[model samples]
Target: MALVDVDLALIGYGGATSLLLDALDRHGVRGLRIATVDPVETARPHRTWAFWTGPRDAFDPILDAAWSHVDLYGPGGAQRLELAPMRYAMVRSGPVFARADEAADRLGVQAVRASAAALDDDGTSVTVRDAGGAAIVRAAWALDSRPTAPHRPGRTFWLQHFRGWWVRADRDVFDPSSAILMDFRTPQPAHGVSFGYVLPTGPRTGLIEYTEFSPARLDDAGYETALRSYLKLLDLPELAVEEVEDGAIPMTDAPFARRPSPRVVRLGTAGGATRPSTGYTFSAMRRQAEGIAAALAAGGDPVPPAAYPRRHLWMDAVALRAWDRGLVAAPAFFERLFTRNPPGRVLRFLDGLTSPAEEVALMGSTPLLPMARAAAGDLLARIVR
Candidate 1:
């Protein structure tokens, strides 16, 4: 088998690899030999990644939409939260793929169109064997960003599944200045909860989605019924369905390994970027990519650091435990948080950027006693394990 050597090997180029290449390109890391391995010819899936961040992006050319404020509806009532420093933005995969390709080409990123059959890290270097049993890439460091599935069930697990419809109406039916972060006005599941969110690309059109954080997923008919009912509740004009988007993200407190071996580091969801309480991965994934790329460009160790701090992960574990045990109701829990906390605090907390003082105040907005008990139980379970 022919062996090709590189300075760094990216086992998958779907999302994280693309961003890493983009960051490396922007850094102008000269003469850094990189190989990206993925069997797919194009990773341009019709997906939308939403994240709350500052107003600037290196990929602003492809941004689908951005909102300065968001609306929240819960059992108590409806409220609007203004986002001053941070804006919620959506980016389409097609544009991201295109932009990343441009950057990869400019940075001289070698593309390897092969499925990874095996990875061997021998402490000194890492080797990647393709599905055809060829040792295609050997490098001092490797970033394995292969897409992961939901396995290793945690004590608390939920499927954050959703179906979105991109529709356009004859008249202006959407508000471009703001988006609906969460609308708990939708029907609730017996075991979990249901909500809806709208991202307005324009005043007359946008994508509306019905989402649930439940242990089980709905059948085709069930999802259709729920989404149709939600649309009816909004009382919107008859619109032309332009496209459909759907996917499911696993929200679990299970530990994800960042490094499978000494020289091989994981990235994206495999590296524990997804938040357990809120199925948000884009911001974390981007953050990790930038950090790793920056370190590499500066001639530092490129092994990924923990996506979220230990304290934050512990808090997430406790929150997930409370959610699974029904100690804190999802709808009411979020409602109280948004209503009690100042604007942008909850969003920052979700982004894992909240300070300790902000977190303490945010915790006060919940059922403190019950949450504390849940935290204690989680801690005890971990200790026993």
Candidate 2:
């Protein structure tokens, strides 16, 4: 029948929209009608996100914990890395959603609880339709965060999958000062690479996970086996498992369609926020939300910017080819990276923030010959195809 008309409508109210609303609130933008289309409101989050950034950001208030340094464990030994200008932060999704809801209410943003099945974009406005072909809402612009299965046809794909446990022990077992970014001491996977990640909230409390980068995800029992094996490496007392978090992030070289139509744009992972190599997405989406907020406030186009430059994407594609083809030994590869290069440089490079010369230096630290060959092969394969 009638529609909930607004200036802008968000198809999903997860991290991307929340961050956008948070930034808009911070910038004191007002007088525009906004609405969010989501099927259900989340009361609790079974997931956690970990990201590294320089300085503070909008989500700092709800940050569960932060670490100024991190431990990188490899075949040789463990090295304590000082993240000077940057700090690693963790945020649970439940609190993040709550914060966004509060902001939406204050800004008078409406919520339509319906699944957006289709978006029809005219030159001036977009109409969101549900599965039954009913108009759910209409807006001048639509930012769709809905994610499809990441298995894109005809693209190189990989999975960054993990199962983590929030555990506590009576004994002070963890060095809480620095989080463990990667522990390669855990048994390596037969196909891809495997590592242990630890984020200690305290001496006896932390989230420990067994992570793998491979073509497919492991089953529940497979994850349990790997996690238990990793836990044994840490000398501790009987553990109390407080929570469990499990998920798979798609790592792909497929170019995402940012604009489905003139008035409809994509956000979050579907918009190319996840890095193909590391599966880190929060930081990229966070940066983009801020940009979108600024543009809307300044009476400018609010399209989300490219998450990373084409050159950076090309480099990541080459790395993926190498890893997928078994051209480089990942454990020793990453081991030498952290040991030989400045930790900040490596972290920046992962974010695609490093300069060309710096990138060359970093590439020099890897198996240069193998990577160069991989890059050449990747180029030729694309050309012939």
Candidate 3:
């Protein structure tokens, strides 16, 4: 068969691709032949995407829930931080994907149900193949948002694994106004950190999750055990689980190749959208999508901008190193951070929007000795590498 030609080819129709498609549509960039390759038949499974941003965000239209007050619990006590003018928002994947599909249909973008086999870029055009080694399509430019290269042994890497259950109680047992960002009362792991996250949708319904940042993933049974333990700690009434969601997100300071080739660009987590410390990607992915759309609109090469700010990257590296080396206690570190600094400042820092002075102030809130040691060690490791 003759090779099919398109203006652009998107390998995976996930968060990044959807955002890019949305941006393209908003900019009135239409009538271009585009193809999306993915194996999933329908929309992706039900998962929640959460991020902290100002009161008004581009994604507010699709937000399922938002909380202005977040609670943090540790050995010290509980701290309720008010995020005025900024709120933490959560959007269900089902709705977001449905919206994206609608946009794709309106924009005349084709969806192919096949896994990508190979990608070849030769300056002028890019070609992609299916798993059967058959030519899928050729395009002027292709954005490959497939899974990233595997983490090599000895590389500083961590996995943010989580299992969440949507539960309904027999009676009102949750405060819908406040979300529990972290509850460290649960059993702590030997290494890394573990916490419970709660997002109450109603007085009797909520999503509770057991999340961990560790070198390795936990089994299904392990997660269930932890969830049971957390529920017991909460001492809520009998509950019925309506749904369950599980996922593992990569958290690393390792470099990701943004431009694998002149014509093929990487997107999403593959392009380093995952924040090293918090494992947040949606906001960063949105920023990257906007950048690509702007570049294309300007008739320039659509290479995505840097995934994250340089200073933010440095802070993430240092924090990851500190956690990996067990230089500081996870609960204590977080308690200090939330207790010492204004909630908005900490949230802004986590979102990579804080200025240099704000960042310095945030750093000063933490234990100086451990941070200094971690910074020095990270510097030495980078120098020797």
Candidate 4:
């Protein structure tokens, strides 16, 4: 049997790998052969990726929309925040995946339509196989961006589950200039919290989602019922559903190894790109892709940097514990954070780009006693185990 040789073999053609391809193109690193493996021909599904950043971002070319202001509604009432010098941007996955696929084709990267049944790496090369046959890809390195296996039980785990509908109305009912970041008027869960998110693309059309942060996920029927109830609450006459998008994102502090072997590295959610506190991963994955590309171009090891700063991880641990224990009300905690700190600072903190002073100020906005107790309990549990 003949073996296939390339500079890199990507295990999945998802967001993380796509971003890596984009970075490689940007760096003008061409002529390196590559192979991508994925079972699906199209991207996972129609979905929207939203993140906060300034006007200049690496993904500006594929941005679907951007909002300069965001609204937060809670028990304290509606607070409209102006995120000047920063924008809340939304990018649809279709465009991003298509662009990446085009770039791969242009660069002469081979797309292998098969599931990777097995992977064997020996510090110099990685050989992957499928039931149909086997192919030994000799390369300096390989990247596996496949979705990670389920988290082990008894590890602090939560899910940011959501179902959204792209809706259109007969009359103008949405303001396209701003987004409704969180509307806590929805029914709250006994264990966690629920909110409604609105991203208006036009005066009469937008994507409205019912999102929940909880230990368990809801069935499709459950999400549909919630969405219907929310639409009734809005009382928008002549509303029509254009499309639907739903997904479950893991929110856990469970450790995910980035470098599973000396020559093979993990990417995307498999590499801890998803933040434990907030289910935000696009920006983190982009940063990881950039780092990986730069390292490979420099003839250095392409090990991804830590998914997040140590301090940020500690904060996430305490917050997750406190929320799971119901020590503090999730809606009120978030409302207070947005109410006390400036929106830009909060966005930066969520993006893991906050300074020491900003972090301290942000911490001061939370329920101190509950967080302290949660931190202490977590520490004691770690010591005992």
The ten-residue window of minimal lDDT in model 4 covers: 147-156
Tell me the whole-model lDDT of each prediction, alpha carbons only. Answer: 0.85, 0.85, 0.86, 0.85
Off by over 4 Å in 1: 149-153
Native-to-model Cα distance after best TM-score fit, residue 364 in candidate 1, in Å? 1.1
- Tens-digit lDDT track of model 4 for 356-379: 899999999999999899889878
What is candidate 1's lDDT per residue for 1-385, written digit by digit as tens? 4677998888887777777777777776768888887888854567889998787877677799988889999998889888887888999887777778988888788888788888889999988997767788899888988866544657787879999889898998888999999999998988888999989899888999999998888988888898788889899878788998888887888877788788888888898889888889988888888888788788887876788877787888888788888898889888988899987898889988899999999999988988999999997988887
Each prediction's total of clashing residue pairs, residues at least 3 apart in sequence or on different chains, is: 0, 0, 0, 0
Give the lDDT of residue 11 in candidate 3: 90
Tell me, by lDDT, which candidate is best.
Answer: 3
Each prediction's RMSD over C-alphas, in Å, is 1.6, 1.6, 1.7, 1.7
Cα-lDDT of candidate 1: 0.85
Compose the digit string of candidate 3's lDDT tens values, residues 1-385: 4466898999998888888888877766766888888889865767788988887977778887899989999879888989887898888887677767787887899877788889988889988887778887889999988878744432368989999999999889999999999999989899889999899988999899999989898988999999999999998877999999999998888877888888988888888788888888888888888888888777777787887788898888888889889898878888988898989898887777889999889999888999899999989988887
Who is ahead in TM-score, 2 or 4?
2
Better of 1 and 3 by lDDT: 3
Clashes of 4: 0
lDDT ranking, best first: 3, 4, 1, 2
